[model samples]
Target: MPFLDRLQHWAALRPDANAVTIGAERLSYAELVDRASVRARELAGESSGGPTVLCRPNGLAFIVDFVAAVARTGTVAVLDPGWPALQRSAVERMLQGAGPSTPPAAAPADLRDGPSDSIFLYGFTSGTTALPKAFTRSRDSWQRAFATSAAWFELGADDRVLAPGPLSASLTLYALAETLSAGAAFHTLERVDVGDALDAVAHAGVTRIVAVPTVLRLLGERGLTSGVDAHALTGIVSAGARLDGATLASVRNWAPGATVFDYYGAAELSFVSARRLRPGEHRTGSPTAVGRPFPGVEVRVLDDAGRASAPGTTGTIFVRSRLVSAGYAWGDDGSAFARTGEWCTVGDRGHLDVAGELHVEGRLADMIVTSGSNVYPQEVEVTLLSGLGGAAAQVVVTGLADARRGTLLVAAVVEESGPDAPAVTRADLRTAAADLAAPKRPRGYYRITELPLTGAGKLSRRLLAAWITEGDPRVHRLD
Candidate 1:
């Protein structure tokens, strides 16, 4: 069944059931569909055949308007609420002066279905250094993903889920749609507040959580100190970034009964691999492992010659699944995607272990070549995070231009506490990184008060590199 059709079916079957709740405003399944139908009809009347720009904040208004546009085949273009002024203005202009306006009514009982491959959403990539690239998604593409992820994660009608990030993010948006498709209640915050998120989970007894690692880390930190019974949560699914060992431990401690899921994928490719982290278990697989490939998803590590690489051999990661986006809608930066028949690769570098588990090396573009050896930053970053223990709040490993080694390995450390935090010296790092090869160790370290984060909430090494090189006043030289 189509994604929206599944939602409509749930509304009729469970009219009084809660569909979505934001702040104090709770909408039943029936009411949400009714409002969305009315808005969709309004949108249909004002249709100029251009994409509908949804730039509203996280709230009922955004949800209803978004559904309404989708129902009418209005070609929804979801923009980040925090977009810079220039990008917002340009996108709005491309929308041909048409905008979503509030209006009142309900969807027809019998709505006709359109071609499944019709462009439904212009999902933008969460790029921080440049304008977000707009990618296209068909109803069928995402619908297949919804079914696959729901079945893989054991999501069902009984799951009361909360996705605490802005719905603009693909991870959060998928969570919202997946919850609705499963006939479950979806909870979101108008703004991301740790206290409010905790209260919602405690008050409504949220059974599952879908958020990025940063949000999950904050929730876990607050949950542990607040003495809240987050044990009601049965699952915590984290994506959009790698989950460090420390954050994983903290999550397990806070939600003793919950299974923590950390996945590594991209916006263009919905889900690739994920593993369940249980209490008392620290290791899921290899340090760089992202777990086994998701059900119905095929993953291969291909070398330069387009042949599958041997196990434990790093190469460009390729994914084949219905979840792959229908390519970019507009900004087609030639290097972003490549195709080999039905299989597609987004330039992520990784390898498969002997157990067939995927180990994310890092992005191909982010790989640093130093002294005739290539280094994947994720490997170095993981080792440093584990070695620094709780003393390092966050650490980014990048390669700087060098006069001799081609590139110099540098680790930018953000200590947990401020400047008074215990210093993590080169000797400490060496001991912590004892398991890794010697060449991967950081040649120098910089202690910074804060780390820049991308729009998707992951640490932004690109921005950090620029800041350090340009002598951005915020970065302190500790080495």
Candidate 2:
């Protein structure tokens, strides 16, 4: 079925039901359909093809703009509307090109490769893989994501879902569409302060929330977790990056009644695997394990030969699902990464445990080579946090330059609670990692006040590495 069909069906099926609520603004299914249709009509009148840069912030406008674009069969680039003006201006230049009078096409004319039979609203990966390729997301692909992923999260019509993160981020965009598919009310947050997010959720009477782990850390660090009285929340999902054991434990403790679903999925692949905290399960765990995939999804670990590896054998993870993205658009032709008829994976490295649960080690592209051994940043980050520093609020691990060793591992961390205000010395952390694999030990350490996060609140390793090398003037420095 097409994307608009889902929205139209929901609106017609339950017109009186509350469809959206955004900071004193509310809309029922009927109102949302009417408004969104008008938006669709407006966008359809404008242009030829490609994507419309969804320039609005993370609120009712973002949702309305997205729906309008989709209904018009025009692609949309969901960007962090809160990006620094310089960065945003750069994006505007890149996307919009020149002045409106002689404006370059929204997308390259040749960028359109898929069959013109049915065009769509695909998002571009921002400098993520191979210079930010575009994913040609068909209407069927994204709609199935809403249909199937709903069962994985167990969303229902009565649920009030909140995507507090920016609408420009893929996760929030998917959550927005999926919530509507399940016939649930979606609440939009214009601002993302920890206090404001908590209050917004409470005010909206939100039952489910999808956010990155960084937001949880900020909420925990700011002490807003203690003040929030959002008893209505049933589930809180933390994704994008691994959540430290202590950080995960604290969030669970803060919202004792709510179930926490920590997931790991790549943008190229839809929902890879998720672990929802059950009643008796431990809250604090090694972040490596992201648990099992949803029912319809299939995961395989392939060696360098692209052949399936034995259980517990670490290799690249390839996912198969109808909901997964189609091949990315490149110069002239599109390239499919490890894909079959209905599945595709974004080069994540992992292995399945004896229990058949998936444990994502790291991104294959992010693997660090030091001396003779290859290092996975996720493993090192977990190691540094668990052994050396002992539960830092946030940690980003990557490879650093070295003339002698070729390349060395480096870790940047932030402490949530410590008398030093920044505890966990670099020497201590390195010594800890060295105990496990000294050859691949981190040579540099830095304490940052506020870690840079992507639009979806995930830690940006690119920015983290740049900060360590350039010596972030804003953060306290320690070499």
Candidate 3:
């Protein structure tokens, strides 16, 4: 069944059940369907089924607008609320010029049976240029993803999922859709707030949460301090960034009843791989190893020549799956997403271990060549986070302009601070980083109070590199 096609079934089965909740606002399944049906009619009359731009904040309105737009095979371009007015205007203009590829239905269908290839979303991601790149997703791609992930994550009608991020973020939006499609109650905050998230877990009977590692770390750490009861949570889905050992440990301690499932994926490719960490089970071996291929997804590590790489040999990671998007809507600079036959790649570098576990090194663009040796920052960063123990909360490795080595490998460290956080020094970091090859080790280290993050809450390596180059005051060099 299509993603939104399940809505009527859910509404008929549980009309009075809570479908979506953000803060005090609540919408039952029946109410959601009725409101969206009316809104879809209004939208069909206003415009000739053109693509709609959704730029609102996290609230019931965003959800209603999105459901209404996509229910009739209408394409929606989601824009970040944090984006500047000028950037939003430029994107809106670009979307207007591009327009929809396929004409939408003249009126909303009683039960939408749109073709699988019909585009429903135009998700934007930062690219090589100033304007964010747009990618199109068909209804079938998300429907497949919903089925695969829902079963893997153990999400069902009884699960009350909480996603505290903004609705504009793909992670949270997908969570809402998945929860609604399963006839489960969806909970979220008006904004990203650890206190509110913890409260929901403690009081709102939240059974599952889907968020990035940063938000998970915050909720875990703050919940521990505030004595928030997270016994109701049964699952934690971590994605959008690397889940460091410290954050994983904190989450485990904070929500002992919940199993943590960290997955690796990209916007172009939905879900590539995932691993479920049961309670009291620690992730062993290489920290870079994400997990095996997701159900119905094929993973391959290809070298520059497009040949498959041997086990443990780092190469470009490629995926062949029904969950992949319909390529970029516009701004195809040829540097980011590309395809070879049935396989697609975002230039992510990784390898499959002997046990078939995938270990992601980093993106091809983020690879640092220093002193004639190639270094993936993710490898060095992982080593630092694990090696330093509780001394480092986060680490970002980047290359700086060098006169001799072409580019100097360096790292910015966010020291773990608190009564329980262990003390660390430059010497300690250097000693910890000895696990890495001499060339892969960072030549210098800087202390940062906070890790620079993008609007989507993932670590921004580009912004961090700029900070080092521009000598940002927040980043201080360590001896």
Regions of model 3 farther than 4 Å from truth:
97-113, 127-129, 369-374, 401-407, 469-473
Clashing pairs in 2: none
List ranges where model 1 is wrong by over 4 Å: 93-107, 110-113, 278-284, 368-374, 389-393, 399-409, 416-422, 430-443, 466-474
State which candidate has the highest lDDT: 3
What lDDT tens digits, residue by residue, belong to model 2 across residues 59-167?
Answer: 6777776766655335666655555567655554555521111113223111112322343544556553333455656666766677677777778999998777777
lDDT of 3 at 462: 77
lDDT, candidate 1, 1-479, per-residue tens: 14678888888899999999998998998898788777777776776656778897899998887777776344688899788888887776765633223222234653323358777777876654466677877788887887788877879998899998888878888888889889999999988788999999889879999888877887888898898789789999989887777678778889988888878888888788888867556684567888889888899999989888999998999999888888875667656776678898888998998889898878866788889887888888887887777788777887778899988888888777546778776677667667778788778778777667665566677778788889998777664
TM values, all candidates: 0.89, 0.86, 0.93
What TM-score does structure 1 among the candidates reach?
0.89
Error of 1 at 228 (Å): 1.5
Models ranked on lDDT: 3, 1, 2
Q: What is the C-alpha lDDT of each candidate?
A: 0.79, 0.68, 0.85
Candidate 2: minimum summed lDDT over ten consecutive residues — where?
97-106
**What is the C-alpha lDDT profile of model 3 across 434-460, one tens digit per residue?**
999899989989998777877666778
